[model samples]
Every structure is written in C-alpha cells, then in structure tokens.
Target: MTDAPLSGLPLPGLPLPGPLLPGPLVDDAWLAARLDDPRLVVLDATALLPSPGHDGDYSSGSGHAQWAERHIPGSRHADLTGELSDHEAPYHFAVPAPEALAAALQRLGVRDGSEVVAYDSGGGIWAARLWWMLRAISVPAAVLDGGLQAWEAAGRPVLGEQEEPAPAAAGPLTPVPLPHAWAALPDVDAVLRGERPGTLVCALPESGFDGSAPTRYSRRGHIPGSLNLPGRGLLDEAGRFLPRAELAARVGAVLDDAASPVVLYCGGGISAAGAALALTLLGRDDVTLYDGSLEEWSADPARPLVQQG
Candidate 1:
C-alpha cells in the first residue's frame, strides 16, 4: 500500500475532475477551518443499525431525532432511510436512481459545484454510506474522519435544537452516475462462479461473517470465498480511521494483488461503505460496493454462504 495521500490529481478508477476536499477523509480541525465556506455543505448522515438481538429492520431507523438533540454546527440531516434510499427496492438502503438521488440532495441544498462533508453520530459507517453515494454520482464529497464522537472529544462545539439552522434551500444538482462504482447481483454471481476476476470482501464482524452471530438475514455466514475485514477493526478506540501506516498494515496483505476491482459488501451495505472509504484513503480506487449486500445475497436460498473456522 502506498503511504502517499490522495492528491488533487484525478483518482485512478474514478473518472472525474478532482475532489473538493483535500482527501476522502478529513479531520475535525480541517472542517472547523472551512465551516464558513459558502461552497461547503456539511451533512449529518446518521442512521442507527438494529442491535444484534433486536427485531428491527437493518435500515429501519433514522438519526433525525438525535440530530435534533445535538449535531455539528451548520450541518443538515441527510435521511438515509427515506429520501436518500430507494424505497421501491426489495432491500433496505438500496442505492436510488441518479435522478432521484439528485433531487433528494438538491432538497438538502447540494448544488452542482458544492463540496460536501458527511459525518454520523455513531461510527463512520453511515457517513461513509453517504460519501459512497455521492461518489457514485461523481459529487465531490468526503467523510468526517472520527465522526461526531471525535468532534466532541476534540472539544468542538455542537448545536442543539434551539440553535439549528433553518431548512436548506433547494439547489441545482445534476447527477452524473458512475455505474462501475456499484456491483450488482449478477456481477457477484460471476465472481462466485469463477467467471469474473475480483476480490469479494465482507466488512461484517467476525461472528457475523462466520455464522456464529445471529443475523436478520435469511441465512448467516458470508458469501462463499469472501475475505473478512471487519469494519470496526479499521478504526481506533476513538472511532477515527487508523493512521495510514496502521491501516495499510491491516489491509495491505489481504488486498495486495488479490484482484483488480475489489467488491465490498456487508449486512445492508452500510459497513461495506466504511471499508470502501478506507480503501479509497489507501489510494485503491478500484473498489466497487455491493448495494444489496447480504440483505439481497442471503435472501435467496439458492445462493451459497460459508462459515469460517
């Protein structure tokens, strides 16, 4: 893995001009300095996951109430469960059509040239999900490295309901979809059948990946032939991404020459986005997210899954 930071130069697989942020991952200090920039749009893309034993749907909950209670200043809440997702899809948190996504983002004041920074109240998974979505549309966006926890740990001030800003006025955001950024069921099946060349990465926890933990899906374990890289292991105690050296040490061997395009998936595609963000930060732009992930994969009984020893 290269220690070099993502520069202004166009990324390898992503065909675009350049990113608005310095990199795909930004620290709280970096954001604090640009809070007042008119071109900047800060988003609180907080979505709560169901606890292991809970009976809630994977993408059932929103963090709007939590955001109303407290959030970063000047940040607007982006609804991942509702407007930002494809409600018509069979699985939860499915990526919406480009035009639908563009309209939803426009309602949140994302103009064509706007630079966005997304952060979640929990681990960076939800925020990364939004970042991945923005990337699919070729929008210039980045994730808040440590999320709300890190922001508060650094003594950054947060806004309460009383101090919240008014609803963002709509802006003109045209979607330029990058189809290659996503991997569909057929694509994954091809990889499983050995007809395609790619790496299948599962971002779930060890137990979830190995079928030891209870799951909401029709089956447990992971897609056959997947390599495990738990999303939680990608972060430090404070929920920030590990330093580049540490991150490289953890994922380098698994990814080193494994394949050209790395296909990532998790329970409902949320945690996989976190992995995707980590790989992007590591300068591996040849990453594609499985939008349906386990939710779609495990639903079909004909599809196979395997448990790790």
Candidate 2:
C-alpha cells in the first residue's frame, strides 16, 4: 500500500528497485546449472484451466496425474486449487491468506533464501500463477520459460519416480502486505466508473471477448471497456514469451503509458497471471489480477458487460 520502493533483493538476473532485467523466465540451461543448489527449489505447478460445464475441482485435473507420471527430477508438486487457495470462496483461484500460503510453501520445503523455479506441462500458464502468487508474498520466484516443453526440447531429463522433499526448518518467510498485487470487486467498479487511473485487460480468447463463445458464467460477454489481449498470445510458437521489444509493442497499444496500472482478468485468475507476468517482463510493474474474474462479474446482473456478435 505504501509508495515506498521495494527493498533491493536479488532476482535471477535482476535486482529489485532497479530496471527489470531480461525477465523472470528461466530457461532449461539456467535451471540445469542450479539444479543442485541447496537454496534452489523446483515446483511443478501444473493445472488445467477449467472450461464451461467442466468440473471445477482441481484435484480431479490432470496436473497431479501428470506429476505422478513424470516431472522434473526432485521437483515437488504445488496444488493451485487445493492447498494454494480458499476452496470455500465463491470462485476459483482466490489468493489465499499469507499465513496459509506460507504454510503451504513450507510444506513443500520452501523457506527464506530459497529461490523457486516453477514449471508446468502447459507452457507456463499454470506455473506463472504460482510464480505471481509467490512474488505477491514477496518471495523470490521465477517461471520456467516454455515450461516442460522447453525442458524437453533442451534434452533435460524428467523422472517417472517421484521424489519427496525433506521437511523445511522454521525460518523467516514473512510476506510483505502488497495490496496492489490483487484487485477486488470495488477496484473493478472504480475502473468502470472512470475513477481509477488504469486499464482493464481481458486475458481470455477472442471468442470469449466477443461474446460468441459459450461459457459457464451467467453472461457471455466481457467487462465494459476492457481490452482483449488473450493469455495464449503472450507466448510464441515455441511457447516462450515474445522478446522484450515485441512484448512491449503488443501490450503498449492498449496501455496509455508503460507505468500505468493494469488490471488483468480471465475466466478465473489462472491465465490472468500469464498476462501479468508478460506485463512485468515489459517493465510494467503496476499490474494486478481480478481473482473472481468472469465467474463473479458475469453472475452479477448489475455489472455492465459489453457484448458483440
């Protein structure tokens, strides 16, 4: 909440409070070099974005099954829907309280000074969510560029046998209160009222943006005044994020200024994280995710939505 600059913490190739470096995306070569570092922690944050009429339970998703079948050697599984969220909430992907998140990371052997690298089978969609969540809590984290696909392309080995992590000892895992990392319903309302100085970005595909696609929500349109920048487009043919200049060009069109705040939302909040990460890589740090997204927005009849087709 405070405008104070973030403390200088060393990220992979960048330091906080200074100019952002290339990105938080870690390639297989970089990860391979640090694989045996005692302070390093690898997490398979695989998850399936739910579709219309699909079961909302993340436990039933293919993420866990895939982790069981094959995963990066020594990487632990982090359940986005199960242990990382408040399942009782009305919508999915609701960010958990700091204590709850700390406990979950602790269980996965994460602690202070542990540099976390998250990867998933589905490019970095699921992994970016976990990375954003960790950074929201002020933890040093990065996403595996192109995720499992990139790892395989680099000839990295994945193990079929699961390896359990040793229990983490107690240490300082304090979470700095960063209110700007998340956007609540009131924030969206402020955006709608033109009282906020920011842009609203819809991270869903064009079908959903244009109201032509069927959805599970009560309504089938997009938030009024939102700009469409599908999460899928954040990556290229190889599933890696576009080069910095290219990323800046794509997102710069809708954003008035590089430093202006932007609120990102998708069906839930999963893909929104990808959008947020892309923005971060472009040096637009004033980004937040609308956790409830369409699930809450569309269900509210009073909320305004602009439809097309």
Candidate 3:
C-alpha cells in the first residue's frame, strides 16, 4: 500500500541491499554460501498437491507441518495455500492482492532490498511459484534448484523443530506490478481465437494433456491448441534441471519462435511456474503464466478443452 521505504537505516545484522539475485535459478552451492548473508531471505515454499483419489483440497495438503518438522536452516515457511494465496478466489493458489502479498512477504522478513531464494521439499514447483510471484511484484528472487532434497544430497544440514529460529520482525516492502508476468482468461481466450499472437503451453504430464489420466479439474484434457510440455520433464534424476542444451532441446521449439509470447498454464498454475522457470533458464524472457490455468478454464462450460488426437 504505502510506497515508503522500510524504516531503520541499518538493521542489526542485515546489510544494505546488494545487487539483484544472480538469476532466477540458483543452485544449492550458490545458496549454501549465502546462508549467513543478512541480505538473503530463504523461504521453504513447500505446498503438496493432493494424492491420487483424494479430494482436491489444496488447504489440507499444505506443507507447513513438514516445514515445521524440518526445513533448510534459517529459512521461513511460506504458506502458499494460506496466507500467501487469495482464499476467496475460485481457484487454488491464486495470487493474493499486491498489498496482501507484500504484507505476507514483509512478515517473512522480506525488505525492499532482500534477495530471496525459495525451495520446496518436493520438486521445485512450489518454489518456482513463489519465485514467479516475487518476480511479478518486482522482487529479486530465485528458486533453489533441486530444492531441499538436493540440499540434503549435498550434505547440507537442516534444522529440526527444536532448532527453529525466532520469527524475524516485519519489514517494509513495496509491490510494483509486472503486468506481463501474468496472463488472464481473456488473454488465453484471445490466444485461442487467433486474436493474439502467443503460444499456449500446457505444463501437465502427457497423460493429463491427452485426457488419459484422472484429473482434479472439471475437464480431463488440456486447453485446445496448447502445446504439451510436462514441467517435470525438464528435470534430471536428481531433481535438478537438465543442462542448458538439453533444456533448449526440450523447450526450444515452442520458445524459439520470437513472433509470439509463450503463455504457460497447468492444473492450477503451480506446475506451470516450473515450466516458466525452465524457459527463464533457457534465456527466454517473453513468457507469461496463466494464473487461474485449467482449474478456471475447465470449470467454465463455455471454454473448450480438447483431448489430444
């Protein structure tokens, strides 16, 4: 709401704001070295999706309990389905209002100059979602590649429930919206109807895209005219992203055509962020995420979702 800078010239340990994050995707090594840096704000943005056959209850699948049990040392838990999301929205994990988001991040110790690194317990989807949200609001942030699993694999020690640190004092943050970072229903509709020049990408798995797998959404398939590129496919066995060449090989066709922007969407916009992160790593900047994604698209009877041929 207020554009005023955070008061207090120098917080006890936090240094003055430094440069923006190195990039959108930071490795475990990059983060390990900066764990003690006052300017760095690490977050455990872990939110689990419902298991197969379970009710599609996003709230019930929150990762707060897992975060409370164990998490990256000095990192705060970001409740993606709760405080960080818009509860009143029809879709799960909807981005909250700018002011509300700023408030939430501030409460998590995000100051104007803070460089945030977000990681999750599962694949990097939740972390990428948080990174995308922060980027949309002009925050300098990055997702921890491979997430907490990689951190552990690298022998990084985590803090248990008994080792949790005291909550940091709230700080000031100003939200500067990046309009191009998001695509709404109208944007997707325009792209589908040939009124807009953009690529519609579905980040769901092959089965989900082809209507062969059970889905939590109202519909079984993907939006018509969308390309299939599973978000998880971009990762290697260790959950780290594949090398740049391999990443380009998988995503280049859809992204290389500079004539149109790439509009990415998924079940509820969570996995899509992972795809968006991949594109970012590939050095593609002309990408936008469909916020409501299929959860909103399929819910509408007027919208068409077609099975793969």
Candidate 4:
C-alpha cells in the first residue's frame, strides 16, 4: 500500500488461475474446482522455520531447492526469507515494509482485485505469515487447509518447476494498517512494563518456551509470564486447523474470552502467525503478532526473560 504500482490496469496474465474461497482455510476440493479464475492467484509461501542447527541457513541455497521439488501445479512461490522479509531489519524474518510488501506482491502476480490462496510444506506457518501480512495491509487472502501435504495425500497432481508468475500490472495498493492485528517491539515492552493490558502467549513448543530445547535466538526461555501454546496444538495430524469449537476450547482454556486482548509471539515471528491465524478462525480478531518477537527481545540484555530449571 505504501508502495503503489504506477498503473491501474490489470496485468496481461498468469499460468494458473480466482475469486478466493469464502473462508480462511480452503480445501483441496474447493481449490481444485476453481483453478481457472483470472482474478485468483495461488502462492506457495513455503519456508523452513529455522531450527537450532539450521539458523539463518536460507542463504545456503536449500530453501529454493525444496520448493523446486514439488508444489501445486501453476503455483508461484513467495520467498519469506529473501525477497519478502525486511532484510534491512536486524531479525531474520521481520515483516517487510508496506511498500516492500506491495512491490513483492505485484511481482508475484497479485493485483488489487486478486484473491490470494497461500500454502506451505511446513504445515501452514509460512502460509499464515503471508496471509497475516496481507491482512495487516487490509488485503483479502486465505490459507489452504493442510497445505501441499494434504493435496498430495489426496492424489492431486504436482508441478516440479519453481517458476515465478508474470509481473502484475501496477495498481493503487494503499496499505491500510490494521492496528489490532500487529504487535511490535514497543508493544511487547509496554506489556513488560505493565503499561499494556493483555496476555503474552508464546506459540512455540513447550521445550522452546521452557528453555529446555536447543534455541536459535540470542537467549533461552520466554518473555516473563508468557504461556506455552505450541503452534501444533492448533492443528490436527493432517495439519489442518481444528474444528472451531475445539479450537476455541483449547485456546479458551488459556484465555477464555473471544475478545480478550492477547499478544502472540514465537521465534522470529513465524509460528506466531500460526497462532494468530488459529485465533482468527475462532472469531478472536483481537490478537496480534509481536513483529520482532523473541529475536529482537532476547538480543537486548536489558530485556527480561524467564527460564525454567
């Protein structure tokens, strides 16, 4: 939105084709039916969340290698690490500026009127990050239910090429910031200082939250008083989000009110989107992601962290 493409006309084309699905999580059946909508664009927003041994390894050439192996036929890839994230930022996967985001999206063949469906091989974490970014800019987008694994499991055909879509025509992409949807470093500081009213929820696994597992950040443990709700808890074995009632129940056990103000964070802010997306599906639109997350917080010795023995 900050970076609006110069032209208002639609770009000439894409190899695959939409209007998006009605909900945030579209299924194999739903996507398979409408693969030819001109206004529809499918993006494989796949990126491996960094592990202790693989921290900051996107530069080593493995990210693109995995993408080239298999993906939805005719789908374009959105690189969360290299092209899409804010490389200038100190953190590894910081969200790009509105201008940067708008430009990258245009290159990926997203028009002002395009409906986007994002999916990833790492469940939906990477996909949800893209979806959340679009939502932050007030753009309409959705995540594929269960991602590529589900599609493959259902015997769907896959394309091995890792090609990008034709550049879309320029359009007025006014990024309307959704205030409630994003929580930055300052917000987390405010929470730590007791000037903000909200719950801090770490969407990382229990080991990550408890500082018992290998970490990729500058420090171990979590923000003081944060609860552990591993992102996997929000999804089933097939990697699709859980049913609404069940989802609400699992999350509600921690924060009962659907309207409760909660700030979600995980390492580098990726898994946080998974939690944010799950909360969105449960009709809890009050949640936000700490953009810098632990990557920013832990690096500063002045910021307090809580660790378990």
Q: For residues 1-309, what per-residue lDDT tens digits would candidate 1 score against the true structure?
A: 112333343568987654448878888888887787666899999987766673223436888988988899999999998899998999989989999998898888888878899999889999999999999998899999889998998999998884446545566898998867999999999998889999899999998899887787778889988999988889999899998899998998677757878999999999999999999888988899999999899888889999763
The candidate scoring highest on lDDT is 1
RMSD of 4: 6.2
Give me the runs in candidate 1 sitting further than 4 Å from their true place: 1-20, 54-59, 162-164, 167-169
Per-residue lDDT for 1-309 in model 2, tens only? 112222345678774343221247777877776677666789999876556652222223537778878788889889886888887788777788888888888888888777788999987889999999998887788898889888988889988865556655666676765779989899988987889877888998898888887776777779988889898887999899988778878777757553257899987888889999998877777899998998888777888888895
In the range 1-309, model 4's lDDT, one tens digit per residue, is 012122233456833323345767778877776666666688888876556763222221225556688888768888887778887998887788887888788878876777788998988888999999988887788898899999999999988875654645666566677777778888887877788888899998888898887677778889997887788889999999998888988987877742248899998788899998888887776788988988889889888888884
After the best TM-score superposition of candidate 3, give how far the Cα of residue 116 lies from its true spot, in angstroms: 0.3
Stretches off by above 4 angstroms in model 4 are 1-19, 53-62, 165-172, 257-259
Enumerate residue pairs that collide in model 1.
none
Clash count of each predicted structure:
0, 0, 0, 6
Question: Between prediction 1 and prediction 2, which has the larger TM-score?
Answer: 1
**Candidates' lDDT values, in order?**
0.86, 0.80, 0.85, 0.79
Ranked candidates, highest lDDT first = 1, 3, 2, 4
* Candidate 4, poorest ten consecutive residues by summed lDDT: 1-10
lDDT of 4 at 142: 86
lDDT of 4: 0.79
TM-score for each model: 0.91, 0.87, 0.90, 0.88
| Candidate 3 lDDT over residue span 52-99, tens digit each | 452232334789888988799899889998899999999989999889
